[model samples]
Target chain A: MMKYYFSTEKMSVGYHGQPLIENIEIALDKGEILTLVGPNGAGKSTVLKSIARQLSLIGGTVCLDGKDVEKMSGTQLSQNMAVVLTEKLRTELMTCEDVAASGRYPYTGRFGILSDADRLAVREVMELVRVTDLKDQDFTRISDGQRQRVMLARALCQAPQILILDEPTSYLDVRYKLEFLSLLQELCRKKGLTVIMSLHELEFAARISDKILCLNGKYMERFGSPEEIFTPGYLSHLFSIETGSYDEENGTMELEPAGGEPKVFVIAGGGTGRNVYRRLQRQGIPFVTGILFSNDLDYPVARALAAEVIEAEAFEPITQTCLERAKKRLVECERVICCKDSFGTFDRANEELLAYAKHIKPQLIVQTNFEVIELDQKEQNKSQEQKDHDKFNSVTQKSKVENQNQTHNVRKEGIAPINQKR
Target chain B: MQHRRKMRYTAAFLLLGIGVLAAVALNVCIGTVEIPLADILSSLRGQTIQNERILWDIRLPRTLAALILGGALALAGYLLQTFFHNPIAGPFVLGISSGAKMAVALVMVFLMGRAVRVSSTAMIAAAFLGAMLSMGFVLVMSRKVEQMSMLIVSGVMIGYICSAITELVVTFASDAQIVNLHNWSRGSFSGMTWEQVQVMAGVVAVTSAVVFLLSKPLGAYQLGEAYARNMGVNIRLLRALLVVLSSFLSACIVAFAGPVSFVGIAVPHLVKSLLGTAKPILMIPACFLGGSVFCLFCDLLSRILFAPTELSISTVTAIFGAPVVLWVMIRRRQERTA
Candidate 1:
């Protein structure tokens, strides 16, 4: 058997003696990353807390380096494992250096004074997390992103073989999220630190985790490699997501499409209809898109946002059957939108279809941009009303902008508002 | 930058030391019986003079008691604040002093009823039991209510209850016993003998030294209990040590001087603000000094403010210390909003 560095067997975790998730078994090698991912309140944090020993396990045994974790003393366990919890640190009058140096608690002298070697370790970890410049700044005064980095540095300074974090990237923006996860990857690679953390962002978890555990509040839904866990139709079912769709392969998400019969037909191909499909979706206008190859860059977005997508096989020429289907959708739609600027030999059928649309409908609006075109005079009146509404919105938006400017100027000059001044 | 911080710490310590020396000197020199500096000097040099009885017996013991017991109170306050992670937490605010007062009063009343004399150790033991009882109640309340404000409120309620009980016991005592208990109950450092000073100094010194040794874990504890546990500090043991040490300090103060108000709370906050950091390693000794300085000043004011009539030490401490507590609250509110 391959040697496992950390493992939990038949572990049950909960609060106040009531088990929320039971029989969770996880095994990992020395340098692997295990991520727990689920919806909110799905016991991801509960399991992570139990593994970190922040909470008492309801049942079962957690083993580290072939030793039972419960059997080890707190100091020994702390030397082996370090954790960054979700609870906000309410530290007062502490510098970032002080916060990070606290990780040396187990190694310090009787007075908890940091040694030169301990200081070097703190410096090294702070540098690793790019928080060396913030060493003297108050921990509470830093931005959330910087604070998370400092917390990671604190955990790193523990010099542990295992690291556990609960939603470490929850407060971080996109760039910091990427940086934080990448730093974890580096730690795993360079220091051989085995990381077990719960993550809210499934995309980051998929990209960064070596092993993934799916939780659903009642049980460990699945535990395997990221490739095994992130599959088609699995995440949607796990999260019970009904309002949108998640793309496991590309790690993208799309809002729910407008649900109605196709009122707008988009003749698009070669990644041209991506923006048009999203715009129509945003406007709640049901649309149908066609003549897209299965491997087209815009195919996933169209499939996600369009009421219907007519597609061909990758690298296959447009066929007669696809043209017939497109014609039927075009007839059903009151307007046809051509997103392509030019056509190739493979799109000869789409060209023929466009010609058919122009011949059949005399008032065909051939627009380069994907602006909505009304079919009848009555629809044109509706567009006129929409234009008036847009004009009104613009006036209000301008006034809001001017109000913001006035407030900014007043604040800069340290003056009260006009009404408040009276 | 570290060198600059170290220099600042050194300067602060020097300033506090000087302030303590000045306060002690003023406390000893300025009294109702205005002994000349030359006479005081001779008395110090073992020349038994006209003012010798006043200096050695009255001024010296009272001033020493003020210093030792005041430092003990502040150290106890620091430990309680750290334990609760509440800036306003202190021996008096947390009802610990009142609890000690109640126990000591009960013991005094019971022993005096039987015409029995209580030893200094017996009084300390009684006061310690009372402090532990109140601390236990507060700890249980803290677990039930996660809000620090609620914990403080509950602690104040406990203080009121303990004080009421102590008053009831004092109410039924005979006039002769009440004469001595009355002054001590309202909090005064008067009538402290040299023997009592030695006992209190020994207790306070040993306790403060243990607190200093615990600076490492106490520093970790400032991050909160969960983080302290993760940092390998035994949460249970540290908490237990905090309760015992704080109780011992406050019990000693209550047994000697009787529930002196606000010094326990105010001194630590002032010391922390002056030092510009909350590192327990620095704060433990600084707070002790700050407490000594604060009490010495208050005691001096109490002695000379009304000339012939003396004011209670609690009255002076509340006049000075309550405002600091209010300032702490206001600053904390602003910090939250900011």
Candidate 2:
């Protein structure tokens, strides 16, 4: 039988008489998969090493099964808890069977001769980790993932009640990552090994961990079920990124750009519009791309994905023929998104096209500096650049402009729309 | 499984064969009156031979003495390294060699010049006694210092103190006694007799058997002290037994050849590199052969390098030993960083 509960008082740890991390209080129960999720240098590994008695606690006590952990001998501590460190073991020339047999250290007597019972225990644990077939091979020659499984097998040979792992999935690929988690889950469910691990992936931890310990600055920022700790506000604070929103029904966070969706009317050329097209499709926003010559990379991506495109002739300038089609499409769209290179040059005919859009004043969402369009005589004649740059300089000034000149109902999430400016 | 066992057997036989051939060649070739191999072989076959004095008196005793000392020092190095889990640890790490040198210095410089004229055998016994006494002090101190590095440092301090005492004693010695002491410090097997060989071989053979039986526990020790204890090994008993065994081995070799430096440190490392492991079963015999082979080669170099007026064997060994140690240290650092 294993004793699970300890005091909730925080503990302090140090190495070689110098303090490392402190004020960390945690309570672990049997049959629980608790994960410590933090970025590098957040001291997640320090906490685990302190619990396993691999490192000394400088100030506070670590009571295991209601007794001071420091008082117990190595054999006793090893029997209660096993540790899997991140070191790539260089103990080659030993077979897998030999490596696992070392876990019976506390049980064997002075001569190190194995008893029948010890041999049986080693075999059973080898089978448990499903590494029995690779038992005969030299440990070094095996793949890293297989070697990790072998290490887990050795830990199980100790028959430890608590298994502590540090970055167990760090070297694994996507497929192995899922399989490893499932294996740990099965072990926790069936054998009641109190599993504690650290992870880098947020999605994997949210899916598998029973309790998540989110470490940020010095203390744990949040410690609870994954649903409570993985909200938009908490994630935004943790990662310090701009876009963070959660979908309660899907149990996933939606990280879209600030100011909801821009009602973009994309004026893309060649296949420059493909990425924006798929991004809008996944985001479930309205958009249009085109004036694509017949054989542009963007034209096929837009066409194949059922995006409405205004097609034009291959290698042709933005003539009146293509402009008439684009003008017709631009009226229905709320904004115009153009790639910087859509127009061939500063031709007089393309200059007329820019004048027409300036007259309507749609929200033009372009990827690059549209010098051909911005430097057109028609846009300069309107003097829109100075007003546009000045109006976006401050939220207070933009809001005043938006309130005074409310001609469009664009419903932008956090920005002043083009038509709303006087 | 049978093939592995067979290969091990073949290796053991090969080591023994090479040891015997080298022992005969080195014994025959190196002496003031260099006996030919044919005459040496004939004398052994009980045929009346020329150069009988050279074959029996001068060469035979010295070569046998070298073999015994070489094998014992190597075995001692093997046991100490395995027990400590540190590749560089040696029997001399406990300062036993310095202690023995101190005792020999006291006998030659202080006692022998006065009314007490100690025999060579008595001086050998005195050196052996001094080494055991130092080992006893280290054993007592090891109980207090829980850390391995601290214990090693304590041993180093003991060596330093003992060397200081020896140097102080040397300041008052007569010139003849000083010359003898200088020769002893250089670690030679030149004037050894069959009587000394008879004494050393008995002690070495018995201790080797004991170390062979203790190999399994020593293997567990290479993992670590805590790991060895968890494996049900009695750490206290094994540590005491290993100390006594290695001390006896070191004492016996120092008694015969006067504390040859490199064999006790380098032989075990050479064996481990060859076997690519720390397992004692393979390491023990490999160390035994490698030690003998290394010492014999050093002995040969000492005689030939400066020929008729031979340089000390210790000088030759140090010339070779220092560089090898540096290389191993550099390689270990590279391994750790890698």
Top candidate (TM-score): 1
Query: Model 1, residue B337: displacement in angstroms?
Result: 3.7
For each candidate, the alpha-carbon lDDT, in order, equals 0.87, 0.68
* TM-score per model over all chains: 0.91, 0.62
Q: After superposing candidate 1 on the true structure, give the runs of residues whose Cα lies further than 4 Å from its correct spot.
A: A364-422, B36-41
State the lDDT at B165 in candidate 2: 85
> Which lDDT tens digits does candidate 1 get at residues A1-422?
77689999999999999999999999999999999999999998888878878789999999999999877788888788888988887688889998988888888878878889999999999998889999999998899899998998888888899999999999898998888899899989998999999998988889899999999989999999989998888999999989979988778899999885666788887777777677667666677888788888999899889888899988878789988998887876656777776789888888887888776763444333333233555534544554566576888556445533442332233122221332
Q: How well docked is model 2, in DockQ terms?
A: 0.15
Residue A362, candidate 2: alpha-carbon lDDT: 32
Locate the minimum summed-lDDT window of 10 residues in model 2 chain A: A413-422
Candidate 1 contains a number of clashing pairs equal to 0
